[model samples]
Target chain A: MSEARKDDTILDVKNLQTVFFTNSGLFRAVDDVSFNVRRGETLAIVGESGCGKSVTALSVMRLVPDPPGRVVGGTVTLEGTDLLSLDEAEMRKIRGNRMSMIFQEPMTSLNPVMRIGDQITEVLRLHQEMTSREAWAKAVEMLRLVRIPEPDRRAQEYPHQLSGGMRQRAMIAMALACRPALLIADEPTTALDVTIQAQILALIVDLQKTLGTGLILITHDLGVVAQTAQRVIVMYAGKKVEEAAVEDLFENPKHPYTRGLMASMPAVISFGAKTDARLNEIPGMVPSLTNLPPGCAFAPRCSLAIDRCRAEYPPLQEVDGDHFAACWRAAELVGAP
Target chain B: MTDQRPLLEVTDLVKHYAVRGGVLRRRVGTVHAVDGVSFSVAKGETLGLVGESGCGKSTVARSVLRLVEPSSGAIKLNGTDITGLSKAEMRPHRRSMQIVFQDPFASLNPRMTAGDIVGEPLGVHGLATGRAQQERVAELFGQVGLRADQMKNYPHQFSGGQRQRICIARALALGPSLIVCDEPVSALDVSIQAQVINLLIDLQRKNDFSYLFIAHDLAVVAHISHRVAVMYLGRIVEIADKTELFANPRHPYTQALLASVPVADPKAKKLAPMIDGDVPSPINPPSGCAFHTRCRYVMDRCKVERPTLVKAGGQHEVACWLNDGTGRAENS
Candidate 1:
């Protein structure tokens, strides 16, 4: 664990700006987002839907299609090499070989006609130029690594033939086939049930420890993050609002938005018989990026919003130790319900 | 004191779909979707049905609602047998029982406004006419925490939470005594899920309505339900109070299911029992005990002889060979 913390940065995303060209206007789906994952640690990007968490992950991998989406600005550096500067062919080589991404929906991400073994072997053969026999053997090995039962029988089955949990396991197997240094998982267990979710999270954590892989886990479930992630990045409306150690974020959340999110979690401890126990809900919906307010994006909903909050955007400042919060009144907003 | 006169009583409810095969499309096998499941919901209590995916929890819900006709069973609503009633005959009782589906966006009619969606129930039941119907729809909107003026808005215009509220308002239009909520909050985000769960709790308190809340999330279910029932491959393996089910689960399957839920607090260490292998296919389920294949304490008797639901402790019942003391001599 100490060595993982000291390893060189595997991924450094700086000031990444992703925009969506809709009929309405150019919407900044990812606005000046920046984060980094250590060589063997997990950095979780936590946010609700439409909060640009997935958009930021997609931007890093350059998977966002160009017709309706485009990465207008950013420097995605892997081991000091600028990924954005690379050409399409070079980036393609780096994508599956260096930094693989496991998408949210395995049912759609997987090739319908291809066998599970062949799908993984295809990545190996395409990237490493391995023979069919070699790729198949490597594919089976990868499946076994993920702890998928009866790897041989499972490899012969098609994607549709496997269950949802098995398909997700298969997706993870494919992502880790090339021994990618950084694995970006976007809501990997969202479609799964609680029991299956626990298993998947444990598997990911175990694999990370064993393979010494850096992970960027993007999810809305705080429970998943609490168990797996070493650091947590809180996002809202295309902006990075808070970044801190997982324990710090849970124990002493500085940002009003983060506090509200933490309070809203229906834990067994917080709930009681009282029906009127008002949850700390940050009122109002997430503002549309097409028509974002000039000041702080969260000001419209934040309870701690003051005149300054409504007038100017706040820079991400270090609040306590290594904890960072992008709020105008981060100091004043203490012990928020 | 068991209430024999509960609002809804389901006895050995079973729903099996026949697998078609060969050129003639003959029934080769039966998929035991909801096999011999039983439970009762009192007047206003919420009996949460929770299990993993492919555990047949949803099938039990659909069977109880009569949405998907049960293959064989007894469904008694308010002491009246409603299971055998045909579609046309069940029309009168439809108002007293409603369902709030999982995906509100898909369940709602796209062409209809929010007002029409809620008002359709009243119109179908012939409970209101013209002006009276509009007033009732407005009232229903207010009950579900939606603004009455926004009745003209379409489903697409509302957010995910608001859309689900619309579904709830529609379900509550007829003042149903029981509303089967099937994974209502699973589709929403964490914050939004809290809002909807709170709303459901508040509404139930006000109306004294009974709910068959079915979801895969055990934490949410534990918070809302007074009693919880754990389901395996189309069977209620264990049924107990929420606290008991959480603290001292009897059956191995129930224990494993409860152990698997990840707590939000990282400091709290729980020994989660890992159940290896995927749920066996419903097409050809395990012979004796549906959960015997995955049960850590499987016995020889469990492979051949099925265990029926019997009283294990106070106000709790379990259908496992271990609990019945009929499996192995060693304690489970």
Candidate 2:
């Protein structure tokens, strides 16, 4: 079973550590993170802001700036090719062709001056060997594929003319224009309203299934993760504290932080189903990466922390089946609600 | 609980923005940001105004405080109409209300210390002076779960969650009866959001203050609100008890809003959008029902005749033709 899983894996990240040389000190943004994405599977990296989920996405795309930010360690292999080993030109080819990315804010991510048609077609013209006319036709098809209404007319319109949802559809059109093997969407629907977000997420899932493409959805919303992803990796203070199948992660969270996050979120519970009004708020804030604790990063806020938990960092270990958690007391918290 | 008077009452609230064009900057069109919306918040109760972006929830909050002058409306605070009051005359009314904005970083004065940020409101309202003000600020800090020693720290020195606590402390300083929480916890992380939300709930319990909570998120709204008013294209589509609204939303828009919320239960099936298409542009809003274009149960009458808010029993009400006691809105 493991061998079959390994064979089908499209992207594999191992012990990845990324650091930013800030004025204060060196901030380890992505601290020894590792995950795998199989073909046609949706893997979600869920965490709060500044928890290094975005940095991990950037690292995989090889888009991190070198002067301040650097991938200090680890290997990111896409289709059996180590991305870190590739040169700038080779990596550039892989960036848009084999993999694509969509950002949080659709308004700013899209080109303001350029028409939606030209932007999508430009990708086709660059990577795929297509003429202007063919690229234009493909661009309209791409927009149509994303379920944009009046694709023919919308293609001629500028980004500002289209609505927020329309702009996001256009962005997805550009990203999926080449039918990339891997699509990394970092908070694609965060700026969108829930109604619009539902549409975009549905569009993404439908398109992903139809195209059989691997997806790495980076977001802070567990709801989005539950709706889209098959597997989830929960991050905290730049560390992967929990990794499990989406259902397992939600049903039996083995990490204290993961449990705390699920309890903290007010969205998951139904209206009036809550016996208690006050959410079980995690007592403290995320630890500063620049000045991390000597032991577990989440020890200060965790209710399950013991002397060993505070004295040493726990390594990621499998507690149940494929459900992995980086906590000393993972065994005690197994099958936890 | 003995006081029967509503803390805040808004009636026929309308706020429009002019769309200027070309070199002359002539008023070309009008964007009806908040078009004839009305609601009430009882003392010690939270009236959650939930909607999509640009749906005028924030505008309603701002208009209630007289921060943005309403084009037309009656805003009665504790039986006093302050909507037509002058800036100077509104000062006293302002003391009875305050707002905690969405972005704590942008809302706070970076130059001022946490102490000054909380104390400035006290000084401006003349509630406290010098030594008394300092003491009040420290007490407020303690109430919000911030350390007294950290009162002198700058906004930038604190974390995102800490900054929001400071903003909350500042809002609480005036001893306002009504506090408008404008997405107070949206900017914070899940764990931190809980902390802030719980803090707000505790503060409300202790002080018996009301909140005009405006947020796009339904789940967060349901957490605190006693009653909820769903908005779409600057109109109140439905208003009901939190339990009823969330469990049995009558309006198609409200139903869609509830269904669209992605519950973090992966065991559940993948859900589709209950409604389709985008909310029509507020600048050129639809003629009859502003939500008719995207509404699933759109009818011919829904296209021409605007549906007014109709009672469906109890505190439940909806502004949809489908809920006209008929099973569904069908011209046939």
Candidate 3:
């Protein structure tokens, strides 16, 4: 949890800025975002749709293509080495080996033409330089590790022959084939059903514990973060508004946006209560990144906004022990810890 | 219990699609998409149908509406058996029961404006003409939380939440007593989802319209439904009051589903035994209990003899062999 921990700093991002140049204008999808992932811990980047949570994860893996999106500034350091400085070949070597990423949709991520085992072995053969027989054996082992039933039979089936949950398990098996130290799962359980989602979550938790792998979970659902994440970072309009321990963030959120999100979520405890006429909601849509306000991006919709909030941008200040919030009136609005 | 006449009732409904194969295209198998499913919505109650994808929840919704013709069953709307009614004969009852689809973008006609979309039902049923149709459309716009003046705007001009509101207005044009809402809020953002849910609740209160709300979201379903029916592999595994279903689910599938929902409270530490393996395909479902393949407490007989839905307690029914007073029933 510390910035100076020697073995804890698995992935460090500094002043990351990602911009997309389109026909309309230049838009900052991720603006000066900075965060860190500790070894063997889950760090969740939580936000609404289009809050740069996914873009930050893509930037970390260098997955964003060059024509529309470009990393204009910042550094991504993995195990004390700057990944941005690496050449294409070196980065490719590091991609599936040292750091791997799982996409949102497993159905679209897996190739339909390739068998599940071949796809998994493709990574092993490319990175580990193993023989075909050895790679196939390793692929079967990986499938079994992911709890796939009848691993030998499942390995020979194509991606289309599997169900949504099975395809996701296969995707995870492929990502973990090289035993990466850092895993970036982008909404891995978003499209899955609740029962299957719980299984997948438990699998990730078990795998992280077994492998001591650092995790960066990006999702819009607060429920997923509450169940899995250790530390939480809240983003809005491509800016980090709050960061705190998972327990502290939910119990005593320091930012208005975080409070609104928590209040808007319908919980089992609050079911069938006819107490209030109006539920807590943040009015208005998220502002376009291209047309962001100069000072505070959320000022237009924030009820507690003041003149000072509209004149200057607020810095992320440490309000409590290991808790950071970027709001001018954080202490007044949320009360001092 | 006081009123025996429900707005909509489905009894022993079944739908199967024949799978063809080989060079001559012979029917080799049948996919039992909806097999012997039954549920009912009272005069003003919202009955939520929730399950995983490919669990036949949508098929039940479609069958009740007679959209995809049911192979065999009885669907009664206002005491009239419309299951065997021909297309021409069923046209009169179309205004009594309507549907609101999940995807607002795909459901609404792109070339038509909001006015035309909402007024189509009115024109089809000959309920109103020219000026009256325009007035009805404007009134519906205001009812579903949209501005009457924006009726001329197209679906493309509205946000996802607003477009769904337009769809709701269209469904309300015929003054239907029942509305089949199939995942209406699943495609929307969380904030917008709350808005749409609240709107649906409000409309139901004001108009006394019953809803067969089908969705995959447990929390949202628990919020708006009076009674809930949990489906798994084309079967209604559990049916009970919303409070009882959430608090004390009897069926194993329902228990696992309720347990899997991530609680908002950080201090909560309850975890259920997660079901393993994917749901078996309906085309070739397991011989006995379709859920036995993934169920944690699967018995030997579960792999051979299917269970029947029966009354367990007060207003609660379950279709599990465990609740039938026998550890496992003998296979026939």
Candidate 4:
């Protein structure tokens, strides 16, 4: 690879929009969202359920269902190639070869009938053009890379035979086996215990650094976003409310929604400061996407909402160097001492 | 306003399920779900039980409430041993102990209105009826941060957070002294989770009821609990005051559990996992210490000798050889 290409962005998404035509009406599950993933960078999309984080990921992968859901608009540029313009056959060649995804609940995602080793070997054989024996060896090596004990023996076991943690490790192995440039993990460790979560997270970070894979992690846990992500995008009602470096987001959140999330989460380590006071709560629930409030979607629930906020949606603007927030009162937050 | 007497005391609780297999349905093996667990919740105190899935924390909660009859144990409520009481005899005892489950959507009856669901307990206990029951139900709803007008709504009509509030209202209708909350807030979203936690804390302060709060989130437990008990496999490995336990965990499992929690700070450096591998199955748990399979400081003695919960210092108690001062000298 050329020096310039080595440092180039792996995934560039612009004006991404996905909608679901439910029985009630059409709702924008992913409103015009745009973000870029640099080479070997980890970009986290954090939001509660119904915030369209998962839809954004599916739109990027071009895996959105068409009958009820579709990526109505977007320019998903992968390594200078517009993935949105590719045909089904062409997209298939690029999917497992250039980008792959890890889903939550490995039991549902992984083939229960197939052996773990055979499942991974299938991906390698299909995308990498490897022979049966070579693929089998590589599958075992990938399992070993994920730190699975007795990789050779475990490869022959079915998904049910492994524990929950092991099943997730197998999923990670399968996702990274092809060494795709972009890896999208949706709530990868939400089902596992904290200890198991720690192990899996450490393995993913270590492997991503070694393989230089651009990771797009979608999760609701702020703690996870703080620990792993280099950059984060905070979504609310299917729109990007805030985007900033991980440190800046935690230290100085501009959007009221982002600030609410940070305030609500009970930090495990408070550096000796006592938090006996009542936890700050975001007053109303997330509005239904189909019946979102006029103008700003978050205006109803936001404490900093002004008359202008209810009259029109606030355009996402730069609050600081590279820190963007879509809030009418973001200037007030920045002006705070 | 705290009392010396414990609101609920559980001693030597053991709940085992016999796994039946083969054509004749013979007992193939025994799953020691809750093996010799013991704890006490003082009056007006909240005891948080923290553990991973399949760690028998749920079993402990159910046993305390007599929802599942323990295979063997003594469960005393306000100095009265209700463990051996029959269903008819346990009716009044049930009024003193209620439970709030994790999934409010599944726990609540969809057909019933929120008011009826909350009032059912009042009707069941024969405590109130007619206008009195309606008033009590409305008051319960208000206490949990729900509107009285919404009492006519069904469980499906409410949001996830609202459903949990209904569950809390139902749990509070009986005016129980001890409420066993099993992951009551885990199902709610992060923003809504804080609302429920704050409500629970405020309710505890006003009502002065003891709580057996079972959860996997250490931070939530640390915030709400007066004392915390860490369970691994089927045993309580450590129990201590919230601050003491969080600041200085004595057991290796407790320490690892704390270190495993991802700090909400990007600048915080990542540390290596203290232990590895998944939690072993409860049916065929390791011999000696249940956590020995994942302990970073494992020793040969830990493989053969089981450690019992012993006083380490102050109010803290740990069931590890490293701190118990028995098997460590020989191994060292």
Cα lDDT tens digits, model 4, B1-332, are 25587888899999999999999999999898999999899998899999999999999999888889999989999999999999899988888888999999899998999999999989978999999999988889889999999989989999999999998898888888999999998988999999999999899889989899999999899888888999998899999888878887888888889988988888885746768888888898898998888887888878888889888877788898874442222123
Residue lDDT tens for model 4, A1-337: 2567455788989999999999999999999999999888999999999999999998888899998998888799998899999999999988877999988899999999999999999999889878999999999999999999999999999999999889999998998898899999999999989998889888888899999999999999988898889999999999999999898898889999988888898766543544345888999899999898888998888877889999899999998888999998887795211
- Preferred candidate (DockQ higher): 2 or 3: 2
Off by over 4 Å in 3: A1-6, A269-279, A333-337, B1-4, B269-273, B323-332
lDDT tens digits by residue: candidate 3, B1-332? 22778888899999999999999999999999998998888988889999999889999988888999999989999889999999999998988888999999999999999999999989988889899999989999999888988989989989888999999999888888999999998888777787888888888878888999999999888877888899998999889888877777778888778888887656774434367777888899888888888887788878898888877778888888884522222121
Q: Which scores greater on lDDT, model 1 or model 4?
A: 4
lDDT of 1 by residue, B88-158 (tens): 98887888888988998899998999999999989988999799999999998998888989999988999
Off-target runs (Cα >4 Å) in candidate 4 are: A1-7, A270-276, A335-337, B1-3, B323-332
Q: How many backbone collisions does model 3 have?
A: 0
Compared with the true structure, model 4 gives a TM-score of: 0.97
Docking class of 3: acceptable
Name every residue pair that clashes in candidate 4: none
lDDT-sorted candidate list, best first: 2, 4, 3, 1
Error of 3 at B32 (Å): 0.8
- Ten residues in a row with the worst lDDT in model 3 chain A? A269-278
What value does the lDDT take at residue B17 in candidate 4? Answer: 96
Q: What's the residue-level lDDT of A154 in candidate 3?
A: 98
Docking class of 4: medium
> A121, model 3: CA deviation in Å?
1.7
